[model samples]
Target: MLDIAAELHEWVRQGRDFAVATVVAVDGSAPRGPGATLAVDTGGEAVGSVSGGCVEAAVYELCRQALRDGRTVLAPFGPTADDPFATGLTCGGSIDVLVTPVPRTSPARSLTARALAAAANGRPTALARPLPSADTPEDPRPLLVHPDGAHEGTLGGPPELDRWAAHEAAALLAAGRTGTVPGCPSTGRPALFVESSAAPPRLIVFGAVDVASALVGLGAFLGYRVTVCDARPVFATPARFPAAHEVVVDWPHRYLERTEVDARTVLCVLTHDPKFDVPLLQLALRLPVAYIGAMGSRTTHEDRIRRLRETGVTEHQLKRLRSPIGLDLGARTPQETALSIAAEIVAVLRGGAGPPLTGGRTPIHHDAPGRVRRPELRPPGTARTSPRNR
Candidate 1:
């Protein structure tokens, strides 16, 4: 339900009761994964989606039922013979959904409100809801866990159980993921659905041009806090890139040096000019950003690399730069070019090769390895004072 946090927050503020259906598990080719939510308020209003479109109607009805009865219900939908006519996914997948009523007076409502508020303010927040298990009665009270290891509400299990669940949820929150974890020892089943809503990743676009404007829109749509920076004040205006979260009139390198970027950040240098590109490329290559692509032709790329190498950038660092920016999509317009760049960014993040998936041997989804310790959890540009800092 954290996906529709803003709407849920407003609903709670207005004392409006609602029901939420969250996907707790999936099998086969389910369109939506765990943590996908479909919420319906008392007024028959809805926000968010649990399935791509297949089982929304059925989930909506389940939500309404939960709202009317003020009871939590676990509804399983699949292509199986059981309740086939009631709800079946055409994608040949199965999903278990937990529909819970969120009355204004319930502790769940208050916990959800706090989680939503934290997410709205760009804070790392997680919501842990106890799913029903055969061994023990499910705890209806959801726990709101923050990055600092503090939590509100409780699972009503042993204190150690809550701590264990909170620790696991914190690990998932650090990775900006949402999914289920094994239940606490008392529950004896995988009963906790940890939904993490980390702050949006950063997208810093250097050089405010037509392509930059298109990229800003695409980046924002992809849930990035996009910033368009350029030294030329006339070119870098909020009017040109209305979708960007911020537009800065500053040198790209200087701005990047001072900005709060993390390993999840994506830097796109579109300035093409050596004065702006070289210094920025040097700094970006050394950082641990997820993507660093510079827009230029092959000749310009070679020239930029030569300059970067001259300025003490190592061969290993230069390899991280993706110059001649995007995939070869034969894009001729600014919007199409932006799409190509966005596609490349997504490909990099998901460890996908920018190639046709048809009849390909590559797995559609890459299984990410175990989480690695991050240098710091604080926002970029903040000092890494933690003892764990590398």
Candidate 2:
């Protein structure tokens, strides 16, 4: 639904009318989960996908018709009694979609638009839908929450449904995950799809010098919204850290006083100076940031840990810090070191053991664009050659 919400906002912003098709139910081997949405604007532009290309064209035609008629309708496409392949979904399952034409200003449309605006401003939001009682067994209602507590709409149903969703939303906010809740009808279970968004995690590099510059560059490329903080003004110039979103030339601990760190944030102590690193480590070890990595040798790490313990950082708290800052990739150069650090961050965020893809089965992204995107290994500064040519 976050994908649908974002794309629908884009569609309307471009001066187009569109209709959304949502899968309300599925019986058999459906490719997508229920609550899956596909929106097609009047201009034939589409975002979000319903089926695996088998029913997109048909869904587009329906969207065009709905836009013309200004009506909201439910479409059941599958092996119905009259036409099996008429709807183009022949995957031996049924998909019931709520096709709602979005007016320039309608209730659902307004809610989604506000939700998108909140997400754009790095705010958290939730979108809730009331499930049909008779049609499905799963608790069909779900609220989509963002990282900052902003949400789109609500289930407008009984207070019980809303309360259950709010509880789930809090959990989703904490974990930054999206999924469905089942058994909400007093069974204490509900089927829902929850998607969470947080501010792109922070990567604070404590040095503003050469290695810091390389790390900042790599961090930005990896989507960390990098910040470079150093007490030294000469080296912490924006020119030195071009890829950094912020360059702070202030005492590291003092600067952290004004910043908020969450479990999603990463604090990297890159300066080898005890004056900066020790104080910054004090603050970082006390915070809940997911990863506190310091760039130092094994000896430096052990020494720092001992000093931290002396300063009342318990072993439990000190466990959060990752000394040496990256996997043992045997990297020797600045660029290679940056790669190792970025890879470690990725591994942490993904909650994986950094294994090869051959062992993984989860989709690279949930409801990622049907359009082919380049793999993560594409070289920097290289154009992504389209897959169509191959």
Candidate 3:
């Protein structure tokens, strides 16, 4: 939802008003999960989407009414047994969406502001909002939580209920998944929707040549903070690597020594030379970086593995390396090869097996680059296009 957030920030800065529609709950066979958000502005223009395409026109009308009447609503739209919209969902599932108006200045706006700021700083966050009662149909609770476990709203139940929801919020932030926990009649799960907003992963390229340049550019497009490091001064200049957030002219191992490498970081050795790539691979294998890739051929990879094993990199660590460094897309050029590698990184992030697209039954999470948007099209000059935030 970073796109939505950036759009909202710009709109707020320009003194415009908008409302957000979020899918807060889903039942059997639902398309999108809880926390899918679509924001509609005063003009009716929107960014982000909640559903596939069934109820957007209905939602836009609701957003216009809410803006006009100054009311926020918990709305449900679905196909009845007799309604043509009954084909609303491809999977024939129903969803409950929470449509809340963001006042010029209110708790909701403040919470969104805080979330945008935290995300800009690369901090993880979660937005926790209570589900409207399936029985009562009137009550709703909204909560926002930071990575440190601090919370802003209550779920309108017991103290224990709020505490349990808070713990769930923190856990969701760490896992980077959006879901809900039902409020059991006795156990008190607190029926809440938690949306995880974490910083993008880090992609570090340990080369400064043409292939490294392509990899850096592709990595940035894929939402990674790209860093290019090399010991050579002439090749590692900022002009050659303008898209990279940082260019470090230092020995690869020396630079990695002072850096923080974790499961959220990816290291790619594109030097291809045995002397440069071997030492860096040896050092990178010791860290917890989620993906370690080296650009080389099968023969080169075999030779590199032999050297790594001799240099004390365990077999377990060697398995973590994507030596040929990409999916077998049979990519030939540097740009195509970079695309293959970046696609692999995305597959790793979402825990996908990177299997062939043919007959793939499992749905791909985050269908679009950003979040959801209002499905209907408004007449010109009726609505403004705003971005989405995760």
Q: Which candidate is the best by TM-score?
A: 1
For residues 1-390, could you state the per-residue lDDT of candidate 1 as single tens digits? 887788888888888999989987765567877778889998899999998887788789888888888877666666634444545676666677878889886767777888988776667899988776454454377888988777888777678777877887888897788877754344443457788999888999999988999999999999999999999999999999999999999999999999998878999999899999998988889897889999999999999989998999999998899889998899999999999999999888877788898988665554334422212112367431211121
Error of 1 at 105 (Å): 4.6
Which candidate tops lDDT? Answer: 1
Model 1 residue runs over 4 Å out of place are 42-44, 68-71, 79-86, 120-123, 184-191, 357-390
Residue 283's C-alpha lDDT in candidate 2?
Answer: 83
> Per-candidate RMSD vs. true structure?
9.5, 10.0, 7.6
- Over 69-125, each residue of candidate 3 has an lDDT whose tens digit, in order, gives 766566655444444433344454556676767757554666666665565456787
Ranking of all predicted structures according to TM-score, beginning with the best and ending with the worst = 1, 3, 2
- Separate clash counts for every candidate: 1, 19, 18
Q: How many Å off is the CA of 330 in candidate 3?
A: 2.2
Better of 1 and 3 by lDDT: 1
Clash tally for model 1? 1
lDDT, candidate 1, equals 0.81
TM-score of each: 0.83, 0.70, 0.78
